[model samples]
Target: MMGRTRMIGGLTAIMMILAMCAGCGIGGDGAHDAVQKLMDAVVAGDVSGVKNLYTLSVEPKMPTILTGAKLKQPIQNVTVGESEKVSDSERTVPVSYSLNGKKTAGSFKVKQDADKNWVIQNPPVFGQVSFDPDLTIGGKPSTKDNKFALPIGVYEVNMVSDVLEGSWTVPVKASSGFDYQGITANKNRKKIKLTDKIKTYNGSMSSLIDSFNLLPMCRKLKELYLNGDDFAFISGKSISSACKYQTTDIQIKVTDYTPDGDRDGYYPIKFDATVKMIAPVFTDSGENDDVWTCQSVQGGRQCAKFVEQSFELKDWDGLVSQSNGNVYYRLADPDQNVGELADVIYAGHGVD
Candidate 1:
């Protein structure tokens, strides 16, 4: 009976030892091995290998951003330390590696998947990010300190801030060891004042109108004057040559300026303006049938028969401008008919 009890006790002790050994192997060594593989893949620039080692949750979220991103300098002398078990299926492993001949240490959290294979739980963080809370990353609000532990990838940063009253969008590339200062410190960020924006819009208005060939209103009036009972007397070409539209004394009074709530760098302004369009009519002088009527003026001739119109325009919107000097305005609204200039007019309105 004693011999049988001893044998049973020995078997139980052996089983317990084997179970503990198995647990240690999978929980500790497995995580360290996985990290080592990851380091190797990174050094070799094997993106596929690196991606395969990531946990399922992290792999898909970062693949596009990680594509084509490689370190400028290869990581060398990578040593993965022993894994500290967090749970039955998780471990935290410390790693040291030389980059640019400088040694650095970091930690990686790893977890076991259903297959009991260790994988990286967190995506590799690439940069030290500090930015204003008002700025958004990938349309999500940033934290106060803005230390974004984002995976290696490119992200669109919206620099529109209520505090700064600035609006712009910029591309931020998150790469290994990148330091992203807030948009306020970014050299590429552009912010234009409301006064400058208004000035730019007003200054480019005439050219904007002319480029769109919106003088057809004046042309139509000339066509009406030239029409006679015996078929239309003026040819299309003749009407074009005889009538010209001139804009002067442009005055704009902005009644309200509203910044776009959703999009940065877009403003809808409501304003009233008095714009003068002078359409000169040329007719044959009684003295000479072939000569058009004209009176000498300062530096130019004043047509004897001409139409002068002063337009009191009001409630205009969809005037969009960027700090890069790009100005876009909607001219297609039926209420604001300047004659098919364009559905939208794009002009460069750089502040002087």
Candidate 2:
């Protein structure tokens, strides 16, 4: 009877030990399955499925920025290796897959949630990547905390600030750790000088200036000046009857070139321009024909009366292209300060 009791006790102990081992095995297998499911979801582009597999502790709710994100290379032939137990509820599972016809290996940190369901702790993704509030990733605004996330791929990062603005591309890899050092605006930027040769959409600066017709602008200003409220009381003194205006000898010399504060591929230019304005005096002939003739002034008829005006002009809001040390002027808002002049000379000749 004693031997039989001893045997029964040994059997009970063995059974208990087997039960505990089985529980551990189940936990490890569950973690492995969870990792496999995550890769499957990524391959299928199932965002919701991917979200469901992440650990509950993840912040910002997995970041919707990954909604349309994609892997640089589609994963194929995924093989989930054995899970290394970390604790009763946590495990690390090794995973291997084919990417772009090449074998790639990675791991997933998995743990059980409150309900004992396996979920990924360290997902093979990037998230909570911080940047300036005016920065954008892949052309989309960042989430709260100036953070964003993306799948394993290359992305275009851009930032707009008062100090500087620029764009660059970055690669986000799986399980590489989120050590993004943020973005810098100095990439691909080069300092330019006013003497640097520049090309515009129309052509060279000289050609662009040559194409501009200053007669219309001059005439409009002269008309406005002559028809001012001070002269409103003057009758039969139309612009055509008073003085004829003409523009000649227009020239431009660029003084400075500056980049836009908020964007790349844009520049503001300042220049000095000299133009000759001629106003020929006209007198009414005392005949019913109403013909007008040039009148003598200062003992000289058809007086070679002309005013050479020098103007300071700037196009501070222009789009200029820079490539391989060559600059191209795109478009700009001409800002000229020709105070009290008959007309304003537009900088860049309104090169839009």
Candidate 3:
């Protein structure tokens, strides 16, 4: 949510700056001259001149947040917004520059940098660079371009191919719109790649995760949770979801593999999940979405819901994994019915 807000604000600011600079005598050369003047003023220790060029919230200096020489010299970073070309003027344009740690106001400008890089030149009546990303280099605070950014993190991948079909790789990559929660919520979550290729059936390298859902086991586990039962003995069995139960069974599936089927990472991670209910006997098979209270079974477990079996998912080659990497067995017995549960069970890799 925070990132989304910033993106919108950033775009808006870019557009505004471009529109205003359209009248300036701004161009590449103008930008250079503007930047050089600002830099010279800064190097000459002219704090007022620098602040005058900034678009502050009125007031030439932030007496409290940032003041005088502190803003122009002691400052650490400046972020120059993208340069806008002036339509009529040959040597003028508008740019936004932010000073770091100043909480000061932003300013508009017209001009170019000393290195011929574009820049905003005018002096503000009472502002200074308060938060410019371009000036955020580690060693030199007065510098711009902050240079290129490097990525972090390490990843491992696995891919399996099909004879006639394409293949699926771990961490399946998918087609994602601009990742918008905007009104046009493009609900279609297909897998598309950087090269613009739609991975119809084969996943590349981003959507791989294995999962299992033992509903009966979960219901039973939930009962244990309701009764404050703990089955901490299961190795790597950290209580994941529905914090109330001890696990009776777990149904997990591998990412690149399918249940009697095949896996293609082009789709979101898919799996059959289950939740078992153990309680005094919450409900019998065939009830609407509901949760009731009851006594307990012989194993010191509460029986808020009576669940006899788990539910297995069918035709699950394409679906999304829970945003949560953890299990979601918490809401198990909201509608407890223990009849004819179709939960999936596996035997390999210590899952049995």
- Local accuracy of candidate 1 as per-residue lDDT tens digits, 225-327: 3331112332223333444566555566556665442235445666566666564444333223333433332233233333565656666543434432234
Provide the RMSD of all predictions against the true structure, rounded to 1 decimal.
Answer: 14.5, 12.0, 22.1
TM-score of each: 0.37, 0.41, 0.23
Angstrom error of the Cα, residue 282, model 1: value is: 12
Stretches off by above 4 angstroms in model 2 are 1-28, 56-64, 70-72, 75-78, 96-106, 127-146, 154-170, 174-178, 181-352
What local lDDT does model 1 show for residue 11? 100
Prediction 3 global C-alpha lDDT: 0.31
At residue 14, candidate 1 shows an lDDT of 93
The superposed Cα distance between candidate 3 and the true structure at residue 350, in angstroms, equals 33
| Local lDDT at 50 for model 1 | 70
C-alpha lDDT values of all predictions? 0.50, 0.50, 0.31
User: What would you estimate as the lDDT of candidate 2?
Assistant: 0.50
Q: What are the runs in model 3 whose C-alpha is more than 4 Å off?
A: 1-32, 35-108, 111-188, 192-251, 254-339, 342-352
